[model samples]
Target: MSFRALLWALGLLVAALFAASLLIGPAGLSPSDSLAALIAGRGEAAALVMREIRLPRAILGALVGASLGLSGAALQGYLRNPLAEPGLIGVSSSAALGAVIALQTGLAGAFALALPLMALAGALIAVLILLGLAGPRGGALTLILAGIALSALAGALTSLVLNLSPNPYAAAEIVFWMMGSLTDRSFTHVWLALPLTLIGWALILPLVRGLDALTLGEDAAAALGVRLARLRVTLVVGVAACVGAGVAVAGAIGFVGLIVPHLLRPLVGARPGRLLPASALGGAALLLAADIAVRLIVPERDLKLGVLTAIVGAPLFLHLIYKTRAAQ
Candidate 1:
């Protein structure tokens, strides 16, 4: 399909899935009632369920998914690495570590916003540390190494907190939060994550020309006036903002970034510039579909979004690795 057609198709799919996410739920209301409740706030009970429960969840599913997808595409394009993903920069793990700390110290319990706030703080700190470690002259290899080290350290600290937790309830909370879900979310999360996500999008969307040039190699791109250093800084900070805000509100919804960009790349003719927006739409649709499936697959079980994504993504990731090896 042409690029325009691909975008149109993806946009329609996202719209459909978003509607499904808003309408399908345990409430089992008719589609008409759901729409009415959502639009007009009719039917007090249905309105409450629609407005207070499903609406925010649907909005977040789309927002978080788009962020992850956009971030992944940007990272892959900038790093020129198929395996690159949003989490590669350690922001997600660092954010998770921050949330875990808040829970462990009862800060999350005492203050409703503490968990997400701390998580955002952790992500910001990780970016600063990553920049420091990568340094001004650092290349992709150096950035990768720095990110890996930061991710490892943050993950280890999170494990340590879980291991030493005295309160079972707190530990349980931490564990579930890490697993990731859209359950019981509110507009507070919607508002909290929106501005940063938009800013990240702004930061990333303009790098299309740079990303396209980089496909020809770093030296060639620089010779073409791509300003490699500026591109790197923008990409890193943008991914941090997107991933940080996402993990802050939704925990760690793994694989949306990895899977969406990878799936849509071939369709975009392997062009990084085209892949970015397509991946964003694809990611939003995939996550919304996944969220809806969670509601339908086991209404009582309350399945975690992260677990489902991992189950689907891990095998595919391994297959990608195998394919890469064979090609090499």
Candidate 2:
């Protein structure tokens, strides 16, 4: 399909999924009721459920999803590595570790906004540290190795916190919180994430031109006037803000970034600039669909979003690895 057609399809899909998210919930509000409540606050309980419960959840799904997708496309474009992603590269894990620390220390309980803030801090630290270790112009192998080490260390630290929790409840809370969900979220979560996410988007969108140039290789791109330093800084900050805020609010919803871009890349063409927006819309749709499925799949159990994505993403990731090796 043409780029315009692809975008149109993605927009329609996102819109459909967004509507599905609003209409299908435990509340069972009719489509008209959900739309009315969301738009005008017409019916009280419908308004409460739509505004306080569903609206934020849907909004976060779209916002977080778009962030993940855009970040993934950017990372892959810059690194020239298809495997580059927040979850795969340890950024999300590092951010999750930060949030876990906040939870274990009871800071999250004491301060409503502390969770995502700490998570964002953790992500910032990870980005800084990773860039320092790998250098601004590191190769794909260097980045992957550095990312592996960071992910391992962050995972260990997260485990240590859970294992050494003061009590079972603390450990349980940490464990469950890490599983990721959008349930019971409110406008507060949206406020916490949206501004940071929008800023991140602003940071990333401009890099698309650089990213397209980058496909011709770094030296060529540099010769073509893409400033390498600016590209690196922009990419790092953009991914960190989006991924950190996402982990903060949704608690480490893995694989959306990894999966969405890969699936939509062919539709949008190889240019990373084109892939960026296409992947963003695709991610929003995929995530919203997953969120809706979670409600329908196990209404009583409250299945975690991370689990569902992992179940699907892991095998697909392995297949990608296998295909990569085969190609080599």
Candidate 3:
């Protein structure tokens, strides 16, 4: 299929899934009821279901998924490693730790800014640590090792914090949040993270050309007039902003970043420049579908988004690893 045709098809699929999300919640409103509530502006219960519940979840899913996809694409392009991902590099874990700290300290409860600020700080710290460990001339293996070290440290800290919490409710909340779900999210979350995600996308979109250049190697990119130092700073900040806000809201949902970009790469002809936007759309669609599936599969139980994504993503990851090893 032509690129345009595939884009159109994905667009339609996203719309259909979104509509299904609205209609098929625990409340189980039909399409007619949803439409009537939307059109007449009545049915307080239906309106509550659509407006106060599912709509925000859907919007947040799209935003979070888009952010993950774009950040993943940028990282893979910048690092020249197709396996590079936000979660693998400890960025998401660090962000989640930051948000968890904010929540546990009662700081985030007082105001809306605490969670996002701390999450961004955590992601920045992770990136700085990775850069220091890997150094300027480090190869793909060095970077991967650095990322693994950082991820382990962050995970240990998160566990320690949860273990020591005085409030059992807070600890339980932290554990559930870490598992990651979009259930019962309010519009407050949508408003809190949307601006930051938008700014992140703006920064990364311009870097697509830089990424394409870098794919030819850092020296080639520099020779081609790409300012390597400046591009690296911009890419790091962009990923931190996007992924931090996402982790702050949704709490470390993985594999959207890893799987979306990898799956869409071929569709975009394997060009990083073309792959970025396609990954954004594809990721949005994938998360929306997953969110709907969670609602349908078990309406009573709280189905974690991260669990669903992991179920789908783990096999794909293993296959990619095998392919990489075989090629080597």
Candidate 4:
């Protein structure tokens, strides 16, 4: 299929899934009632649920998924490594660490924006550390190794924080948040994450040509006037912003980045440039579907969004590793 056609299809799919996300929930309101509530904004409980709860959740699902998907495609393209993803690089974990610190210090309670601000800070630090370890002119292997180290260290610190927590309730809340969910989210989260996510997209969308050139190898791309170091810095910062902002509000929703790009790569003919937009749409659709399923499957238990994504993504990840090993 043509790229335009693929985009159209994915767009339609996202729209449908988005509508499903908004309409499906435990409230059991009729579709007409839900739409009416959303549009008319009556002073009723149904209207409150429709406007305040489901709308924000749906918006967040799309934005967060798009960020992860776009970030994954960009990383895989520049790094030329199919295994590259935001969470795997410690971006999400580091962001979560920042939010955790805010919560632990009671700054989040005191300040409305503390959580997201700290999360963004954490993501920036992770990227800085990654650049320091990898250095200029580092190969894909070097970058991946540095990312692995960062992930491990950040994860260890997060665990230590959990272990030493003074408040059991706060610790439990942290654990639940880390599991990742869209439950009880509001417009506040939507607003908090929107600006940074859009800025990240702006930073990344212009790099398609660079990414396309990169497939020809770094030297060839440099020969084509692609500023290799600048590209790396921009991509890393964009990933940090996108992933950090999303994780700040939604907690750590893993594997959307890892899964979406891989699934759509074949359709995009492995062109990193085309893959970026396609992955974004696919990611949004997949996440919206997952969020809807969270409501449908064991609705009483309130299944976490990350849990379902992991259930699907973990096996695919292992298979990719096996395939990579065989290719090596």
lDDT of 4 by residue, 66-152 (tens): 998998888788767777777777778888888788778889889967877888888889877766765644455677777788777
Q: Indicate the worst ten consecutive residues by lDDT in candidate 1.
A: 169-178
User: Against the true structure, what is each candidate's TM-score?
Assistant: 0.88, 0.92, 0.94, 0.93
RMSD of each: 3.1, 2.2, 1.8, 2.0
Better of 2 and 4 by lDDT: 4
Record all residue pairs in model 4 with backbone atoms less than 3 Å apart, i.e. clashing.
none
Count backbone overlaps in model 3.
Answer: 0
Cα lDDT tens digits, model 3, 14-50, are 7887777777776767788888886675799998878
Winner of 1 and 2 under TM-score = 2
Give the TM-score (vs. native) of candidate 4: 0.93
For every model in order, what is the number of clashing pairs? 0, 0, 0, 0
* Residue ranges of candidate 2 with Cα displaced over 4 Å: 103-114, 132-142, 162-168
lDDT of 1 at 320: 70
Identify the leading candidate in terms of TM-score: 3
Full-model lDDT for every candidate? 0.82, 0.84, 0.81, 0.85
User: Which ten-residue region of model 2 has the weakest summed lDDT?
Assistant: 170-179
lDDT tens digits by residue: candidate 1, 38-103: 899999999999999999999999999998899888877876767666565676789888878877
